[model samples]
Target: MPRPDRPTRPSARSGVAPFHVMEVLAAAKARQRARGDALLLCTGQPATPAPRRVRAAAAAAAAEEVLGYTEAAGDPALRAAIAAWHRGRYGTAVTAGQVVVTTGVSGALILVFLAALDPGDEVVLARPGYPAYRNTLAALGAEVVELDCGPDTRHQLTAEMLAALPRPPRAVIVTSPDNPTGTIIDEAELARIARWCAAHGTLLVSDEIYHGIDYGRRCASALESSAAAVVAGGFSKYFSMTGWRLGWLILPEELVGPVTRLAANLTVCPPAVSQAAAAQALHPESLAELDGHVRRYRDNRDLLLEGLAAAGIDRVAPADGAFYLWADVSDYTDDSLVWCAELLDRTGVALAPGVDFDAVHGGGRVRLCYAGAPGDLAEACRRLSRVTGRA
Candidate 1:
């Protein structure tokens, strides 16, 4: 008897905007196949593999162990490894009981949002931050409040920003070594935010997936300052296990049951083989091997920075950590998506358009991922410089 809002169409949540970088990635792949000279600066994954020890462990587990559903929360050993990893790195009192492993950091965030937030609850995020955080929260019926952060704060939200909000939000996410702009939150600033959130009875979701790949900044944890805060961490970034799709959350004790219950219903359990193999990713031998990847990332960052500067593409963020540099291309073109397409067409180099990250002030911006091979990054910059001189 009621007018149908959809008129028998698909649900509104399905209309969430997709990541434009995926389209660029498709074109880049096609170009690579056609010309074999494509330089990809569009995506965030490392051009590497899981550590040797972890790969060996994965092969052994696949061949030997029964790869069935794990416990809804995760493998006990892997959970303990994550909790211990937190404790050792941040001097925090984390326990395996507080950790719930999910399919990936994406899964952890979805579960936590479902468990902790009701529809209409406000969740604050920094503009020019990771787009998935904004898109996912919107799809889950949360009111996403984006704060406009700028160069003064290193493009990160702070306690001051929180205080300026009209009212305390239900939750807020802080991503250090942030995507697009590789700026790391200062340890003191992070502590201040943690304290503010605890005081305001707000949930703090710290996305620390890129912790180990920093260029020297101390990647602090929310657990260090507030027991009330939750941490969304994963093996995808620093551990070089993106395809494995293994991640874990350090939740407050009260949230552990809720998130695990959601995981049980939503995902049943994470991949059993990934859980078993990921525990090896925590081994000291695995860490030693992964540290070498960090060195390569550093070298690529420097090489790209130097090359970009030579190309007159120097209006960029500090890039304190992570593998991306956020640059303002306002001078070249008003439409970044078009700019990116054209750049790829002419140079066989793909970069992520800034609009994918920040809907505002992103028309003339682009994010360059330096996670590729140094030779490719150097070549992409060369193409850019040659075009700028002619234009």
Candidate 2:
């Protein structure tokens, strides 16, 4: 019999840290309700619906057969299609065996962390990055070493930064078209980082979740250089299938078995219905619909850029891709959490505090997502200008 007074056993890894952006958004929502406001700008989700084809594909799959568990690595057909996609898009040669369909990019990150790191291993991540990389590493009992890469370096991790580390990390994570900043690393920089990681025997995990939403050059995957690299991508952003919860990964041949085993035990497999729908997401017509959304995001990006400049919050990194604008808010306040909270309360305008992305320098900045409707973006800009006294 268990003793009632005994404390519950806890995992060695700490629990995942709360994403501060979610907290800001939640507070903003509550404030909006309290004030009877009619606007919101605190979300990172697309205002548009998932493409018609993606929906139709899922509906068709639902009618055709009973959805069941797929193989842990995912359906062979989807894997093959994903492989074909890489080849067609980037002219990179890859086989279906290297592709592993995941529930989403989040699941892929977990699998990568588990397969790549042992207890007490360290992984290098950029500060002001997607919070998940740090949280996930901590949750997996790995020390997250944050390298400060600010606006001067285009908010990306560089080879010099990696070489400067006291002890080389076991792995390094890089996100092109990164969350918060929306900066895309160029080919030259990516090649250098890949070479550095390869020479150092550091596992490289590239999060290419926003690959298709680029404004200039298409983003490159590290798989283009290092066979040891893991490329995690998803349909949530560019494909606008956030609720579909479908993503896939390209793993090195050697790590495939370990990742497959973990996936089998943890998730069992991604939803068969979502996988079936995802298969159609690869169809040419479905891709066309996705491309249309990309065009809209580009427009939204331009709108936000212009609005920010006009609003006098001009010190922002050039947004080459993704749907966010990371702005320096030190002029107004140092505590982004407090500033964001007050903005939400006073103006009904919500934004993510940088503290959520980088606990060190994030307090002086904020992330504004432009994935909302055009009217919403305009209204947000107006409210932000008025609130900040920049109008």
Candidate 3:
């Protein structure tokens, strides 16, 4: 407590970067309401609804019984379902006791960071990766060391990179079907990195939130390689349950008690209704419906890729999975934030600036999301052609 004579000040921990995509999104919303012509390509997350069965379960849980707080870790049935899901999908020997549900991947990361990282402990991140991970870790007082990943490695970190470091950092994060760039890591490479982390005693935080939305390449879970990896995933992106606010973590046996205790104190529990209904998301009926959404995402990705090419934006990351296309707009402008603003104002096209993700090379890059209506993506491309003068 500060003395009465002195004013209290904000801690240094709060000094973190903002998600500029959210800012662009807010402005896009305002433009949409005012002009009804905004083509929002900046947003992440699938533009779809929860699975039919999952929604039905939510409705049933709300009407059939009292919706109350669940166990801090989560509903036993849901935990078992997730554990089984992981086991079946990745052939990992996961168990219900190791699954700790949280509000979202956001919450799970917070819990794991608190449990695993101490202030000044170094954590490795791929450059131009998800901003939230870097921001959250920074705010938690972790030393973030970003690896300058480019098209050479599909904007991902490799085992060779880690071995070359002065020493193994406290932890390293790997995101497949990564946000912003949307590149999926190679399975063989992922296994090698996992083994390296285990051998070197560095914690590996594998973020697999965008699984099940791949194109030609398949996404691999770190659990398939090493049991020591802390895996965080959510129903948001692939399941189209962003609002349901349900996510989970698969922890090592040693981490279960600590993460659960921290979650119990910090969140009390994830939304009870979500826990009750989310298990249904794993059902066969719901999965069939969800698979249709993935097909549409693929179509959208192709359309966007073709359109960007027509607009003379040739440089791009390999978008093997996820619904994003990372494009180099250096020909049009050196400042992505300004370029995005001008495009929004002139043609009502909202795009995520690269500067939000990479402080080094983001100025001339932009990320466009193709998860929305196909018509909107096409029209946004047409409008963009006028600005780029490539048509």
Q: Judged by lDDT, which candidate is best?
A: 3
Candidate 2 per-residue C-alpha lDDT over 162-220 given as tens digits, one digit per residue, 9 for 90 to 100: 98888778999999999889899878888889889989899999999988888876688
Cα lDDT computed for each candidate against the true fold: 0.91, 0.85, 0.93
Clashing pairs in 2: none
TM-score of 1: 0.97
Query: For every model shown, what is its TM-score relative to the native structure?
Result: 0.97, 0.95, 0.98
lDDT of 3: 0.93
Writing each residue's lDDT as its tens digit, candidate 3 over 345-377 gives 999999999999899999999999999999999
Alpha carbon deviation, residue 388, candidate 2 (Å): 1.6
Candidates 2 and 3, the one with greater TM-score? 3
lDDT of 2: 0.85
Q: Enumerate clash totals for all models, in the order shown.
A: 0, 0, 0
lDDT of 1 by residue, 66-166 (tens): 88988999989888988888898889999999999998999999999999999999999999889989899989999999999988999999999999999
What TM value does model 2 have? Answer: 0.95
